[model samples]
Target: MTNRVYVVGVGLTKFEKPGRRADWDYPAMALESGTKALADAGIAYDKVEQAYAGYCYGDSCSGHRAVYGLGMTGIPVFNVNSNCSTGSSAMFLAAQAIRSGMADCTLAIGFEKMQPGSLGSTFDDREPPMQRHLLAMAELREIAFPPAPWMFGAAGLEHNEKYGSTPEHFVKIAAKNHRHSVHNPYAQFQDDYTEDQIKADKMVYAAAGLTRPMCSPTSDGSGAAILASERFVEDNDLAGQAIEIVGQSLVTDLPGTLDSASLITLVGADMSRTAAQRVYEQAQLGPEDIDVIELHDCFAPNELLTYEALGLAGEGEAHKLVDAGDTTYGGRWVVNPSGGLISKGHPLGATGLAQTAELTWQLRGLADKRQVAGAKVALAHNIGLGGSVVVTAYRPAER
Candidate 1:
């Protein structure tokens, strides 16, 4: 944060269910999204001094493959994967480059073309990265659910037990996100649903109150963002379009995560809280100053739990926020005006950048139908499971 960094442009594709878009490949998706981001910034790909590309299920050097179509300028391309937080990790690296005076212009790109249904481990031979997480869950409870859903679901259950939050709270989140998606053309699922319908949908993890409607589906899509230093923005006369990166922090799991033996810790609630606290401290702004947010709502409960983690609400009081309808358009802050991952589709690597795109639009007053009124400050949260969590705060550039 020594030097000012701004998001000069952002772009994302309409997320589609995996296999439904048979014609789309990672390279094509990356090319289209990257092109749009470059066009949005009114800059040529050759101007980019470095690039960070993120994906989970891609081979080595896939970052190069994805960016080669833009130009073979031979710029350094770093491949990144922090599980689901891949996109935000890429963005963080881009910001670091600018802050360190390494580059004035950098690109952060994330894309994923995933296999349908629940996410599973790609390798079978070695010890899985999630072994400790899985073991922690086993010691906590006996639940038969997919790895991702079960982990988040268990956190929901803990929230219910610790905070008196009910299934109704989680269901309300799903309903709100789905309703929000109705106006988001880029969402993978724009169909609206009532809370009753959301709760009644087929259960994925019943103990944790997770249903089909409450979970983000595997998707295929890409998102990209261009970051520039203050000098670059002024030199290029891009001030009008620049959104300042006021504060950002990335945190990983703590020893307490497993030692505490809490389901919430197992699912990154602590990492998110720690990261968000750091960002808020760095930005000299609290949650009250944020006008809009795009948090990682990979599952409904995670959204509810994140409400507390982000300081949007006090501990164990996130349910009250939902009860008061404070998380929607008419609420204190519009959380996930993009419909979130549950409705927007979680394309692994692309999700964090997609959240960035939505927040950028909101800060610039360009989000159109989903725009939050008078938005100036925005916050984004993206957490990866095997564990990394990034929290970033943004606002329109100062005149």
Candidate 2:
């Protein structure tokens, strides 16, 4: 029989502003999150045959620092940095290890201790990784804002020009995410915001119709997950608590990203679509099959663009889905039940695993107030610039 993988345990640190908890460094965050995952799994760290650590702003061999404190086991530890997708990429690797029978159990950890401010390049000596993307973005809109907001804002503007979506659509998505965060104790900004509040909350990039609240904050936090093969789960009596990873796909930018001059494409929209399609095909599922989602909402525009890309809506019809309240609770599919990056805090490394944690809770009926009732199938989409997108589908292991 082919190997089946399951996420037996997941844990997350409450996301906070960079300086809010000065004592919680990357290692601290990783240890807390990692140990919690091990405890949740009812297993010891030595059981983990391999480990992958994801971080964007840390030094080399940081994975060792994170895992060594948990156990001195000399298992292979791989450090990963794929910008925002760092966490999910690590998760993908861990799943591969189990699926390939390389290991019966593997750990994936992601954490980031960010500096307070808009995110910037850590290394100025080398050419910036996003330079080409920014250059392509400059051709579409004036480079007035910071790199991330500018690119996403331009994409929002293009959506308005191409489709009939208005600035209110983006504002509504921000409002929804902010409101969703109120129920997520782990979210950094758990307070709700009205559309007016979001619109008036200091325009970070006015030309692109982006307000401060619509952008994800720079956060310091960590998340970790333990993945095991079916044999490991059955042997260790973890079946009842496990959540199976049904399908997953990772895709990067194609040539059209630069040559097409589409801001949406420039922001990894095509990659998201490609990845989502692959996952759906692999799982024999469609957008309608999913009951909940935790998409990469690093910016409000990206969330809206992902609606169409993930097949939640048709081309140029995402606004209608937003208008009809299909992306929220009591709708067809509850998106960003974890408050997403906007409110949940986007610690670059922690985000993807956090998404996995949220879905695991939703699938297991562990999410208290944020739970999507009768949730059976869930989907997660995480994207990073330069650019890589990972889309994964999940179902309860018992099912």
Candidate 3:
């Protein structure tokens, strides 16, 4: 039988624009988050049996170098990259290590040192992993210079066309996230804006109804998590703080992921839906059971889309969920309490683990001013475009 895995500790560095921090390299970022996680776990680095490091833009074995600073006990060190889902992928492996009884303790860390501006492939000599979506983009719409906004924006517009929602719904989600960030010390942007401000901001893609404020900005940050088997938690007397990983699922691209006939599928919403469904099934919990959510709001549209994907709303009903005020404080679910990727900054590799950290805090009632009242269960959704989606569920460990 698989053992239950508990997150004993988690740490996150405040997300910031790229180049804002001098001397903040991936290795440095890793150490900061790693040490914090270890301290939170009340454990020593020597207790960690294996480590996984996740990042998108880095050389091979950067995981080795990044995590090596955490006191080289000669454990297995893995470098993991799964597009933007890198962070959660690392956490998945760590949880699996414990769940399978292979290791009692594991460390998962993710960090990104991104370049400024919209994301583009660093290599020109290779067939891009996301070229499938690019091909669909060319067929479906004029290729925008920064294709991310166009793809997501067009997807938002598609939802609007098919579901009778408006871009205003997406901007409202962004504004809500920005308002949430005002209480998040670790978020990149604390400057709150109204839905009108977000809609009227500098346009990123007109068709998608995305403006500067509606999109996640590139950022530099790090996040780390330490997971332990239930036995290990008991032995270490960490029951007071440990949070159980109730269930998690990682899903990759399936049919219609890059369909040219429908632009909405271009952002891989179907995979997110599938993954969330599986996690809910495994956890024996539905979206209704989740009191808080830390979703991959890489763009405002994605947030609205995820509300439906995660079953917080029915088909074509995400906007209605927004109108009902069910996604914020005093609602059915407090989504993105850490401000989410929209305002929290998207540091590719670090994004997922950061979500993990946020949910862990929420479940433990340690989210400070952004805390969701009586948050007993939480969920995290992180996705990458090349593409992968990981959905995780969490609850506080039993005493």
lDDT by residue (tens digit), candidate 2, 1-399: 458889999999999999898677788899999999999999999999999999999899988898888988879999999999999999999999998889999999999999998989888899999899889888878887577888898898899989999889999999999988999999999999998888888888887679999999999999999999999999999999999999998898886688877889989999999999999998999999999999999999889999999999999999898999999999999999999999999999999999999999999999999999999999999999998999999998897
The estimated TM-scores of all candidates read 0.99, 0.99, 0.98
- The C-alpha stretches of model 1 lying farther than 4 A from their native spots are none
Order of models, best lDDT first: 1, 2, 3
For model 2, the stretches where C-alpha displacement exceeds 4 angstroms are none
As for candidate 2, its clashing pairs are none
For model 1, the run of ten residues with the poorest summed lDDT = 254-263
RMSD of each: 0.9, 0.9, 1.2
**Which is the better candidate, 1 or 3, if ranked by lDDT?**
1
Better candidate number, 2 or 3, judged by TM-score: 2
Question: Distance (Å) between predicted and true CA of 168, model 1?
Answer: 0.7
Stretch of 10 with least lDDT, candidate 3: 256-265
The per-residue C-alpha lDDT of model 2 at residue 243 equals 94
